[model samples]
Target: MHVPDGFINAPVSAVAGVVAAGAVAVSLKGARRELNERTAPLAGLVAAFIFAVQMLNFPVAAGTSGHLLGGALAAILVGPFTGILCISVVLLMQGILFADGGLTALGVNILDMGVVTSVVAYALFRGLVRVLPRTRRSMTAASFVAALISVPAAAVAFTLMYWIGGTTDIPIGKVFTAMVGVHVLIGIGEAAITALTVGAVVAVRPDLVYGARGLTAPLKLRIDGELVDAPAPAPAREPAAAHRSTKGLWATGLVTALVLAGFVSYYASANPDGLEKVATDQGIDKKAKDHASKDSPLADYGVKDVSNARISGGLAGIIGVGATLVVGSGAFYVVSRRRTDDESVNSDSRRDEKV
Candidate 1:
C-alpha cells in the first residue's frame, strides 16, 4: 500500500526511511549473486510489468479494489533480492513522478509494500516448494499461497506502523481487522495473478524463471521396457539462438505491458484500493497531506494541461513504463557487471597461482 504523507508521525516515518534505505542497500549486495546474464535484463521488464498490472485494479469487497503487489511474482520469476529492488523502484517512481504515493512516506510504502511483501512471500514460497513436488503445478500452487499471505502480511505491517505513529485517534483493533479483512479479499486477486503469470512464464521459458531452475525431475528412460533413472546431461545450444529466444520473450512481455498500461488502464476502477479504503473508513487518513509532486507535469498519472482523460493517462503510463524500465535495467546491469568483474578477477588470480 502507498502510504501518503501525514498518516505517520515524522519520527516514525524517518525511522522507516532508515530501515528502507538499509534494506535497499542489502538487496543491492545480495542481487550481485542473484542477477546474471540471463536474468539481469528481464528484471527491468518485470518491474515495468508490475507497474502495468498494478494499474488494472480489480474490485474486491463492496467498494474497495486491489491490484498486484508483485512481490511474490517478482521473487518467483527473478530472485528475492532483485525482486525487492524491482518493487522498490516502482514505489520510488510512483512517489516521485506520479504523485501516487507520498514523498515523505516513501519509506513506509517501501517497508510495507517492498520489504515486507517480498521477504515474507519469498520465504514462504521457498518453504512450500521444498515440501511440495518439484513440478510446475506445485510451483504455481506455492506461488498462489505465497501471494495470498503476502498481502495480509503487508496489511498487518501497516497496522503496526500506524499504531506507533498514527496521526489520528482510532482503535488499533478496528483498523487491524478492517485492513486485514479487506486485504484478505484482495489477496485472492493477487494470488491468482501471481500464479497465472508465473505459470505462463514457466511454460514458455522455464530456464529463465529463477525459481524453476534445477526443479526438473530426474529423467526416467525406458530400458528393455522398464523405466530406469537416466543420468541427466547438460543441453547444448547456439548462443545466438538462445539470445534470439530471450529477445522474443522480452519484446512480447514489453508489448503486453505497454498495452495494459497505455490503453487498458483507462478503464480501471475508480474506487479506492484496499489500504486507501481502510484508511478513509478508519479515520487513518484524516491527517493525510497533499503529495509533494502534485504540481508536476505528470502528477496524478496524467500529463499537464491535457484535457483528454484517455490520452493524458495513457501518455503518463507509457512514460512511467519507459522510465521504470530504464532505471531498473540500469541498476541491474551495474550489479551484473560487477559480478562479472569479480568473477574475472578471481579467475585471473587462480590462473596466476597455477602458473
Candidate 2:
C-alpha cells in the first residue's frame, strides 16, 4: 500500500529512505544481469502495465479495496530485480505526478510495496517451481501462491515499521491484526490477477516470461532401452519469427495497458486501500498531512479544472502510463546497455589474453 506522510515519525521515515536507497542501488546492479536486449523493453512494459492495473482497485471488504501490488506479477513476467525497479518507478510517478503517495513517505512505500513484495514473491516462486512439476500450469500456480503471501508480508513489514515509528499510540497488536486481516483478503485478489496474467503470457509467448525460462525443453525418447534428450531442430524463420513475435507481443501489451488505465479504471472502487483503511480505523492517519502536490493539475488522478470526472481521470491515467513507460523504459534501456557494454569488454579482454 502507498504510505502517506505523517503516519511514520520522521526518524523512522528517514531510516526507510536509506533502506530504500540501498535497495534501489542493489537492484540496479542486479538488473544488469536481468535486462538484456529481449527483456529490457519488456521490463518497461511491465512497469506501465502495473501502473495501469493498480488503478483498478477491487473491493476487498465492506469499505476497503485492494489493487495489484505488481511485485509477483512483475517478477514472474520479468525478473525480480527489474520487478523491484518497476514498482519503484510506478510509486515514484504516482508520488510526484498524481500525489497518490506522499513524497515524504516515499521510502516507506518503496520498502513495503516494492522491496518486500518483490523479494519475498520471487524467492517463494523460485522455491515452489523447483519442487512442483515444471509446467506452465505449475508456474502459474506458484505465482498465485507467491503473490498471495507477498501482500501479507508487506502488511507485516508495515506493522513492524509502525511499531517502531508510529505517530500515534495505537496498540501494535490491534494494528497488526487489522492490517493483516484486510490484506489477507486483498492477497487473494492479488493471487488471481497474478496467476491469470502469468498464464496468459505463458500461453502466448512463454519465452517472454522470465520465470518460465529454462523450464521447458525438448522431449526425450527411449532408444535401445536408454532415454536420450531429443536433438535440437534446425531453425525455421528464426529471425523473422522473433522479430514478429516480439513486435506483436509488445503492441498487444501496450494496447492492453492503455485500455485498462484509460477506460477500465473508471469503474474501480473509490474506497481507501488496505493500508489506508487500517490506518484510518486505528487512528494511525490522525496526523496525516496534505500532499505537497495536492494542488498540481494531475493531483488525485484528475486533471485540474476538468469538470467531467471521466475525462479528467482518463487523461490522468493515460498521462501516467505514458510517463511511466518513458521513464521506466529509459532506465531499463540504460541498464541493458551497460550489460551489453560489460559483456563486450569481457569478450575483448578474453580475446587479448589468448593473443
Candidate 3:
C-alpha cells in the first residue's frame, strides 16, 4: 500500500528513508549481475506491468479490495536485484508523478513495498526450488507461495513501523490484526498473478526467466552397467526466442496494463487498501497530510484539459506506461553496459594470466 505523508512520525520516517537509500544502493551493485542483454529491457517492462496490475483492485472481502504486489512476479521473471529496482521505480513514479504515495513517506513505502516483498519473495522462492521438483510447474508453485507470504510480510512490517512511529495513539495489536487480516486476502490475488505470469513465461521462454535458470534437471545416462550423470552441455551462443512474434506479447501486455489502469480502475472496489483501511478504521489516518503534488496539473491521474475523468485517466495511464518504459529501459541499459565491461575485463585478465 502507498503510505501517505504524516502517517509515520518524523523519526521513524527518517529511519525508513535511510533504509530505502541503502537498499537502492545495494540494488545498483546487485543489478550488475542480474541485467544482461536480454533481461535488462524486460525488467523495465516488468515495472510498468506491475504498475498497471496494481491499478486493478480486485475485491478481497465484502468491502476491502486488494491488488498485485508483484514482488514475486518480478523476481521470477527478472532477477531479484532488478525486481527490487523495478518496484522502486514504480514507487518513485507513483509518488512524484501520480501523487498516489506520499512524498514524506516515500521511504516507508519503498522499505515495505520494495525491500520487504522482494527480499522475502526471492528468498522463499529459492528455498522452495531446492526442495521442490525441478520443473516449470514447481517454479510456478514456488512463486505462488512466495508471493502469498510476501504480502502478509509487508503488512506486518507496516504494523511494526507504525507501532514504533505512529502519528496516532492507536493500539499496536489492533493495527496488527487489521493489517494481517486484510492483507491475507490480498495475498491470494498476488499469488495467482505471480504463478500465472511465471508459468506463461516459463512455458514459452524459460531461458528469459531468471528464476528458472536451473529448472531442467540434468539427464541421467547409462552405458553397459551403471548409470552416470551426463556432462552438462554448453548453452547455445544465442537461443532463438520461442515466439515468432514478440511484438504481439508487447502489444498485448502494454494494452492490458493501460486498460487496467485507465478504464478498469473506474470499476475497482472503493474500499481502501489494507493499509488505508486499517489506518482510517483505527484512527491512524487522522494525521495523514495532503500530498505535496496536490496542486500539480496531473495530480490523482486526472489531466487538466480532459473533462471526462475516463479520458483524463486513460491519457495518464498511457503516459505512465511510456514514462516507466523510458526510465526503466534507461536504468537497465546502464546496468547492462557495466556488466559487459566487467565481462570484457575478466576475459582480458584471464588471457594475460594464461600468456
Candidate 4:
C-alpha cells in the first residue's frame, strides 16, 4: 500500500526514512551475492515488472481493490535481498515520477511494503519448501501460501506503524481489524497471480528461479527399463551447485519486462488500490499533503508534451524501465565486482603461500 505524504506524522515519517535508508544499505551488501552475472541484470526487470503489474488493480471487495505487492513473486523469481531492492526501486520511481508514494513517506512505504513483505515471504517460502516435496508443484504451492500470508503481514505492519505515527485519533484496534480484514481478500489475488507466474516460469526454466535453485530433484535417467540416477559429472559442472549461465535468463527477463512496462502498462487497470481506498474511507486522506513533485512534467505518468494518455503513460513506463535497468544494473555490477575481487584476493593469498 502506497502511503501518501500526509497520512503519517513527521516523526513517524522521519523514523521510517532512517529505517528505509538502513534497509537499502543492508540490501546493497546482501544484493552483491544475490545479483550475479545472471541475477543482477534480472533484478531491474523484476522491479519494472512489479511496477507494471501493480497497475492492474483487482477487485478485492465490493469497493476496495487490491494489486500485487510483488514481494513474494520477486523473492521467488530473484532472491530476497534483490527482491527488496526491486520493490523499493518501483516505490522510489513511483514516488518521484508518478507522484504515487510520498517522498516524505518513502521510508514508511519501503519498510511496510518492501522490507516486511520480502523478508517475511522469503523466510516462510524457504521454510515451507525445505520440508515440502521437492517438486515444482510444491514450490508453486509454497509460493501461494507465502504470498497469501505476506499481504496480511504487511497490513499488520502498517497498522502497528500507524498506531505509533498515525495522525488520527482513531482506535488502533479498529484500524487493525479493518486493515487486516480487507487485506485478507486482497491476499488471495496476490497469491493466485504469484503461484501461476512462478509455476509457469518454473515449468519453463526452473534454473532461473532463485528460490527454486536447490529445490529441484536431479534429473533421473532411464536405463533400458529401469530407473537410474545419472552418473556424476566432472568439476566443470559441479554437483555441489548446479550453476547455469544466468546471462540468457537475464536477457530474456529484461526484454520481457521492457515489453510489459513500456508497451503493456497502458492496459493496466485504472483504479485506487487497497490502501488508497481504505484511506479515503477511513478519512485518513484529510491530512494528506500534496506530493512535492506534483508539478513535475511526468507527474502521474503523463509526459508534459504528450497529450494522449496512451502515449504519455507508455512513454513514462518505458523511461522508468530503462532508468531502473541502468541504475539497478550498475549497482549490481558493483556488487559482482566486489565479490570477484574478494575471490581473487583469496586465490592470490593461497598461491603466495604455496610459492
Which candidate number has the best lDDT? 2
The 0-to-1 C-alpha lDDT of every candidate, in the order given, reads 0.88, 0.89, 0.82, 0.80
Winner of 2 and 4 under lDDT: 2
Runs in model 4 deviating more than 4 A are 215-248
Residue pairs in clash, model 3:
none
Q: For residues 1-355, could you state the per-residue lDDT of candidate 1 as single tens digits?
A: 7889999999999999999999999999999989987778899999999998888889997888988899989988898889999999999899888998888899899889988999899989888877886566777889999999999999999999999999999999999999999999999999999999987776566677776556546423344776555433325656777778789989999999999999999998888999899988988999999999999898988999999999999999999999999999999999999999999999999999999
Off by over 4 Å in 1: 214-237
Q: Which parts of model 3 have CA positions greater than 4 angstroms off?
A: 215-248
The number of clashing residue pairs in each candidate reads 0, 0, 0, 0
Candidate 2's C-alpha runs over 4 A off are: 215-237
Residue pairs clashing in model 2 are none
Task: Give the Cα-based TM-score of candidate 2 against the true structure.
Answer: 0.94
The residue-by-residue lDDT of candidate 2 on 1-355, one tens digit each, is 8999999999999999999999999999999988887778889989999999999999999999999999989887888889999999999999999988889899999999999999999999988987886566677889999999999999999999999999999999999999999999999999999999988776667667777666555323344776555333225658777777787888899999999999999999999999989988889999998999888899999999999999999999999999999999999999999999999999999999999
The residue-level lDDT of candidate 2 at 34 comes to 85
Query: Residue 104 deviation, candidate 2, in Å?
Result: 1.4
TM-score for all models, in order of appearance: 0.94, 0.94, 0.90, 0.88
Which residue pairs collide, candidate 1? none
